[model samples]
Target: MKAIILFGHGARDARWREPFDRLAELWRAQHADVPVELAFLEMMQPSLEEAVATLGAKGAKDITVVPVFFGQGGHLRNDFPVLLDACREKFSQITLSTTPAVGENVAVLQAIIDFGASAL
Candidate 1:
């Protein structure tokens, strides 16, 4: 089976998880047949390694890691690639593909405009 892991940069504030978890649930509903997992880069449960391991254990031989983060910042440019390299070594049997960060998408620009319009 194929798995998709949504990786987020964790926050110290507990409330940060609420929205992520909700999004994960929504994704799961949309893709009922595909396995979806959530992971945090730091300050949260289910770190990247753990999530990858779980997917591996669940018979996911092919996995795609998607970053639920904004911008091509340090996490995307540096840390995330390193993490994926390590994960590749650890889960040698699994084929992993990392998607581009969400913020770079055109839809995100529209969403930001809508939010700003609503705020005013």
Candidate 2:
């Protein structure tokens, strides 16, 4: 089976996990057959390493890591690759693919426009 691991920038605020977890659930609901897991860069329950290991343990040979960040900042350019490298070493048999950051899409631009229109 393949697993989708949604990676997010962790926040110190306890409430931050709520929305991230909710989004993970929504994604999982859309793809009921595949396992979906949430991991944080910091200040969270499941770090990326832990999440990937859990998925590997569950027999996920192909894992896709999706960055739920706003842009190609430090986390995307640096931290994520480091985590993926660690995951690679830990789960030697699994093939991993890291998807682009969500903010790079046109839909995100449209959402920003919609928000601006509503605010005005």
Candidate 3:
């Protein structure tokens, strides 16, 4: 089975994970067949490797990681690759890949614009 990981940079505040939780819940509700996980880069419980391992245990052969960051900053450009490489090496059986930061997507940007317009 294929799975998805909503990857994010963790924060010290516990409440910072609320959006991530909501995203996973939304994914589960909308796409029940595709298992989903929430992984953090730091200051969190499940690291990327842990999330990938959990999915692998559940028989997910292919996993796509979507970075929830707004931009392709240093964290995404520098540190993320190292973490992803580690997960790949650890979970050789699973095919792990990542998408660009959500900020890079035109649709997402348009949605943000629409949201702002609705707010106004």
Question: What RMSD, rounded to one decimal, does every model reach?
Answer: 1.0, 1.2, 0.9
Task: Give candidate 2 misplaced runs (Cα > 4 Å).
Answer: none
Candidate 2 structure quality by residue, lDDT tens digits, 51-97: 98899889999999989988898888988898889889888899999
Determine which window of 10 residues in candidate 2 has minimal summed lDDT: 24-33
Arranged by lDDT with the best first, the candidates are 3, 1, 2
lDDT minimum window of 10 residues, candidate 1: 100-109
Backbone N/Cα/C clashes per model: 0, 0, 0
lDDT per model vs. reference: 0.91, 0.89, 0.94
What global local distance difference test value does model 1 have?
A: 0.91
Clashing pairs in 2: none
Model 3 worst lDDT window (10 residues): 88-97
How do the residues 1-120 of candidate 3 rate in per-residue lDDT, one tens digit apiece?
A: 999999999999999999899999999999999999999999987999999999999999999999999989899999999999998898989999889998899999999999999998
- How accurate locally is residue 102 in candidate 3, as Cα lDDT from 0 to 100? 86
Q: Could you say which candidate leads in TM-score?
A: 3
Q: In model 3, where do residues sit more than 4 Å from their true spots?
A: none
